[model samples]
Structures are given as structure tokens and as C-alpha cells.
Target: MTTPRLTPHAYVLAVPDLTRTTAYFEHVLGFSRLWNDGDNWQALGRDGVRVMLGRCPDAIPPAELGDHSYFAYVEVSDLDGFHAEIAAKGALLGFPPRDQPWGRREMAVATPDGHRMMFANPIRA
Candidate 1:
């Protein structure tokens, strides 16, 4: 029998933020600062995956460039506890966490740059 080949990487996101977005990831999400390209680009993460922030032009319009844009998915060991932690930290949560039919419990929050950050956990039997 032959084994099937699989893609190696699953990159999460490359979000855009003008200000305070990097702080939110470091302070709120507990990700460590990797590096910033200075002036316009910043990177942060704990694991191998890193979230890069790119600065938009001074007058660039809104980020309405279809759904192909970046969306961040953050996994938590304890969904309920994580949710509470976010609330306690005064994060502007978009909606309460809810279990989806796809066997995952999740919630979404918007970043300072309008990027959607999703907090999710797999539903166990």
C-alpha cells in the first residue's frame, strides 16, 4: 500500500493594524514579541507560527477585499475559562462563545484593524 502525501504547513494569519494591535496580542493573548520590521511591520507569537502586522497606506480605504483576507483562529485548552479571562481583561468581545454544529466551540473578536480573531476549542465526546 502507498501512503498519501500531505501538505506540511498550515499558516494562520497575517493581520493588519495601525496601532495597539501588537500590544493586544502580547498583553491579552499572551503571545511573545518576535520582531518588528520597524515603522510598518511587526511580528509576535509563542509557537512556530507568528502573526505579522502590516501597516496600511496613510489613506488606504477599508479592508473590504473579499473574504480571502486573513482570519485568525486561536486555540484554547479551556474554552470557558479563556472566555472569562478575556472578559476580565476588558477585551471588546464581539459575541459570547457558542458551540457550533461542526463540533467546535468558538467566539470571535475584532482587532483594532478590523481583523477577526476566533477563539475555539474542539468538542470532545
Candidate 2:
């Protein structure tokens, strides 16, 4: 038997406003629609990242989760270049890209709902 290798397929989110959240991801993060089911569900992707949204109008907004609302730390290359690209697209990032002591270069972006995604790349010597 072989050990299984794992990779992230998507991150699921419960959102109170699906349309607004979807638009933020598309317009700000440069993701494109992968699939959608009118008002109930949607999937968006960019590069190799995929995010799935489920409409949950009665659920507590992600903003209410505080530290528990962090979305994901996506792996990406060209950390600074990606920062410039998304920032120009009007991404409301929480922090600029910086070299981390953990040997990665990283940045962060947040949705109006207050959920956050961190993007990182391994630092090479």
C-alpha cells in the first residue's frame, strides 16, 4: 500500500450574502466562476486555488468569529508580484508581503465579511 498524498481542493464558507462575497472574490481576488447554483452555492478559482461558498443568510457572519474566521493560507509563487497584481485589482489586504522567519514570504487579504486568507511562498536562500 502507498501513503496518500494530500492537496487542498477548496475551502468552504458559510456566508450571509452570497452575491456580495462572490463579487469580492471575483473582482478583488481575480478569481473566476467555476460553477454556481443560482442563490444557494458557488465555486470560484484562480491560478490553482478554489473557494466554495454556501449561502447561509441566517448564520452568524464570519466577522463574528474573531480569530476563528481565518480562511486559508494559500501557497503561491512570486509572492511580491502577486501582491502587486491583486493590490492593483483593489484587494483590501490586511498586511503587505514580508519575509517570515518560518522561511516563507507572505501576505494577507480579507473579505468584507472579515474572513481572511493568507498567501505565502517558500523563501529561498
Candidate 3:
């Protein structure tokens, strides 16, 4: 018997301010708002990625979580183009895309709340 693989369809993030957090995903990262439940919850999507944001004013902000705040690792094509586009849009970049010894090119960025995400593309020969 083989264990089934898990495919993540959406990520839920708690943010202090839903409106502001959604704005970062929308205005900066180029995600489109898919749904919303007034001030409590909102969903944003880009490409095939979906992110659900819930307002949580009392919880510790992601900025305080350090490495624990990282929530997503996404694989993408044309990473250099994506990097250039996001950089021009003022995305808070972690590092420019670079080839790694592990046979991939990777880049990283942090959301306004400090939730980190890594994007990668396979380095082709």
C-alpha cells in the first residue's frame, strides 16, 4: 500500500488587518480577490494559488514569529520575469533569484505581516 500525496489547495493566514493584508496581496503581489465575508475573511488568488486571510487582531503578528512565519513554497515558471515584475511592483523581496546547488533557482519574499514565501523554478541544463 502507498500513502496518498497531499496537495495544498489553499493557505489560511491570520492577519491583524484584513483590508490592509488583502491590499498587499492584491496591489503588490498581483493576486485577485476571489471572495470576502465583510471584515472577517477574504480570499485572494493568483495563477493557481489561493490564499485565505482571516482577521485576527489579538494574535501575535507574523513579524514576531521569525522563521515560524513562513507558510508557502510555490513552484513557478519564468522566475526571472516574475521577479522583475514583482520587484517593479514593489514587492518586499528577500533575495534575487539565484541558481542553487540543489538544481533549482529560488527567490523569496515576505508579506507585510512578515509571512515568508519561497518561489522556485527548476534549473535546466
Candidate of highest lDDT: 3
Q: Candidate 1 local accuracy as lDDT?
A: 0.67
What tens digits encode model 3's per-residue C-alpha lDDT throughout 32-121? 999999899999999999999999999999989988998998998889998998999889998989999999999998998889999999
Give the runs in model 3 whose Cα sits over 4 Å from its true position. Answer: 1-7
Q: On residues 14-106, what C-alpha lDDT tens digit does candidate 2 reach at each position?
A: 998999999999988889999999899999999888999999999988888988889798888788888998899888888999998989988
Q: Which run of 10 residues does model 2 get worst, by summed lDDT? A: 71-80
The TM-scores of all predictions, comma-separated, are: 0.71, 0.93, 0.93
TM-score of 3: 0.93
User: Among all windows of ten consecutive residues in candidate 1, which has the lowest summed lDDT?
Assistant: 7-16
Off by over 4 Å in 2: none
Model 2 lDDT at residue 40: 98
Candidates ranked, most accurate by TM-score first: 3, 2, 1
Q: What local distance difference test score does each model get? A: 0.67, 0.90, 0.92
| Candidate 3 lowest-lDDT run of ten | 6-15
